[model samples]
Target: MSDKQLTELLSLINQRQDRLAFACKEIADWIDSQGDRPVAGKIRDSLKAVEADEVLVKKTLTSLTLERPLPRFR
Candidate 1:
């Protein structure tokens, strides 16, 4: 694939990841706003964990976009 296409794909991937991260944070905030401390803490922790994954996704995406494309498995 051409560099432009790869760049565009990476941009879209980043955008989607950003949205997913934002949604997770929003959900976590909503959960925190509710009463039930224990339940909210647990759920918030899980959501935070998932939100943290966005960092790894961004790093990997950057590496993939900057480096040569990997060979596809047959």
Candidate 2:
């Protein structure tokens, strides 16, 4: 891949991270707004937990990407 492609890939990775952060915020808001027992609340809480413990997710993504070859591979 050219330098341009690599830069684009890194930009996409950053965008993905930003999207995850946005998802976490949305879930947290939903959880806070729930008054009664709601299944959505459970899902929201789960998302919050995952967002709070993102180190594992980061490591996994990094390891997986590092092990994969670039698109230019034969």
Candidate 2's clash total is 0
Error of 1 at 23 (Å): 1.0
Candidate 1 Cα errors over 4 Å, as ranges: 36-74
Give the whole-model CA lDDT for all candidates, comma-separated. Answer: 0.73, 0.65
Clashes of each: 0, 0
Q: Per-residue lDDT for 1-74 in model 1, tens only?
A: 98768778977977986787677667767867776567666766776766777778778767666767678999
Identify the leading candidate in terms of TM-score: 1
RMSD of 1: 5.0
Error of 2 at 42 (Å): 13
TM-score of each: 0.53, 0.43
